[model samples]
Target: MYTPAAFRQDDLGELHRQILACRLATVVSQGPSGLQASHLPLLLEPGEGQFGTLYGHFARTNPQWRDLAEGAEALVIFQGPEAYISPSWYPAKAEHGKVVPTWNYIAVHAQGRAEVFEDGKRLLQLVSRLSDHHEAGRAQPWAVNEAPREYLDAMLRAIVGFALPIEHLQGKWKLGQNRSAADQAGVRAGLAASLDPRDRELAARISADHSAEAAP
Candidate 1:
């Protein structure tokens, strides 16, 4: 991803946080047919590496995984909060007209080779773990067994488990980083003033980042 120095996020911890918050990702790969992309709820296992491996399963009937080489290698894109930045948010726009509309967002790139595991036990374990991870704080936590056994087994059979052994990591945070502090504040203020809940959330995050950066 093309990122200016101000908008670039090299801090591993922050990048990993963004990746974890992103429940879904775009998994892209090159195939004989052409570039293929699949949307999947990816799990990021953080550890010592460029980035921890990503885990997700594909439907067995999905042809995208059919031609893929076994044993891990592909690009997974994890995207965090994103929003359109209106030029109206800029304080300097009225004076010199130096600004243009832009977007603010966070994204992480992970590349690795994937190992396809089809064992029934492994698949069951993977699903159970995933369920726990997502339902940890729920009032009434749901498990795979909440459904009938035959249905669950049939569902599992239709999918294939896989793990990407991560090789590279790239992250960018474009929360108006290229702008001056005053301009960034203006953007954040505008975002906060808006009725959109997502905008308010992003503004809070950008404000927190700014505060952290400005600390002595």
Candidate 2:
């Protein structure tokens, strides 16, 4: 999250958008045993707080939830597209041979107090919402109600629900903003020609950022 002013993303809506795009977040906490982290698909409840609130579940066997003290502070990191930029992609490399390889990526860090709970009603609501959100994109969407009630109930019994009221959020979009315009354009072109779809995505993000900046 070491972001220069040029690369800092302070827009709340944009931060939420990125978090939604990267649904799986890494939640980190500290306890007597030291730091522990869990990867979970968190759902953001926008407008639930000044920054927003995060909802997710943890497996009953996951020790991270048990070690996490009630109302303890946690950091949820959402990572977006990333790609490696070769020095050869920069025009400056040809001009002065001064450019070195770098990485271009976008990330959001959300800090908040986490509350773990085991209310079955709330857990059902959380599961239904999560299922709907993810299934909406599929041609043949699935639902929690599609399964047998007893089976779903048993499955739900094996998990714990948690909520995090976001106190602060930070975003960093490192898309070659430090480089010259020509160098950035070179990077975009190089990325566009690459075989990796992620590289092309980073290229599009870079171009989009530049476009927004250039807009009146």
Candidate 3:
């Protein structure tokens, strides 16, 4: 990702937080046919490698896994809160009429060579962990063993698991950091008052980023 100095996010903890908050990710790899992309919910093991390791699966019928089996490097993209920024929200628009419309968003990219696996025992464990992670907030969390043994085994066999130890990690938080403080405050006020919940989320991120910058 091309990120300006003001928008660059290099903190490891912050990168992990953004990745975890955005559950679903786009995994892209080069295949025999061409570049292929798969949307999957990935689990992050933050302590696994220099950066971290990602765990996820693909349906056995999906050809993307076959591409990954070739040892080609993969890129995983995690997108967080994003919103459109109107030029009208900038105080500079009124002062000099120089501001133009843009977008504010947060995103993280992870790259590594993927390792595919088919071991039934490992598959079972991966499914169980994935289920538990997403179900933890439910009133009654579900487990993999709840289903019939044969059925669960069959379901597991239909999917292929992969591990990618992140070799490179990059985060971009474009929340109008290049704008003047007054203009940023104008954006915050405008977004915070909007009806869209996503706009409100972006406004909150702007506020948080401002606070972080102001901190000594």
Candidate 4:
């Protein structure tokens, strides 16, 4: 991620919050065939290391898991709120017509050593945890043990679990951070009035950043 100082997001807690909110990550790895990427919902273990550890499972039929090695490098990308910024939202555009359209978004990149495992017990635990996390908000939450024992066992056997202990993490948040305060306010106002949910979310994030900057 190419992040300017003004747009860099280095707060570990904030990064974790975004990652959890995003839920899904793009896991990328390199192998003899070529670079492969898989989209998976991952759980982050904050206390696993200096950065953290990522846990997720892959379908047994997914060949992307075959690229994982004990100590091989892996990249996981977590994307948060993103929106298009129109030049009309910039105050400078009216001042001197120097503004151009751009994009505003947040993303976190986690690099780590990949480790793949296939223990049935571990797979069961992984599936249980993943289900718990995603189903918590449902009125009738589902559980791994909700199905028949033989069926659950067969389902678990069709997947493989993996862990990536994070070695490096980088975050980029381009929410009009490089623009003047007036311009940022203008962008926020424009985004707030838009009908797109993503634009409203980007506006809220920008407002939060402003509040954080204003804090003593």
Cα RMSD, each candidate: 3.1, 2.9, 2.6, 2.9
Q: Taking the tens digit of each residue's C-alpha lDDT, what string does model 3 give over 122-214?
A: 999999999999999999999888999999999988999999999999999998887778778888999999999999998888864483232
Error of 3 at 149 (Å): 0.7
Q: Which is the better candidate, 1 or 3, if ranked by TM-score?
A: 3
The candidate with the higher TM-score, 2 or 3, is 3
For model 3, the superposed segments whose C-alpha errors exceed 4 Å read: 208-216
- On lDDT, the stronger of 1 and 3 is 3
> In candidate 4, residue 30 scores what lDDT?
84
Candidate 2, which segments miss by more than 4 Å at Cα? 208-216
Clash pairs, candidate 4, are none
Candidate lDDT scores, in order, read 0.79, 0.87, 0.91, 0.87
Query: Best-fitting candidate, measured by lDDT?
Result: 3
Residue 78 error, candidate 4, Å: 0.3
Task: Give the Å shift of residue 161 in candidate 1.
Answer: 0.9
- If candidate 3 were superposed on the true structure by all CA atoms, what would the RMSD be? 2.6
Number of the top TM-score candidate: 3
Q: Write the per-residue lDDT of candidate 1 for residues 132-170, one digit (tens) a residue.
A: 889999999999879899988898899998888678888
Which residue window of length 10 is worst by lDDT in model 3?
207-216
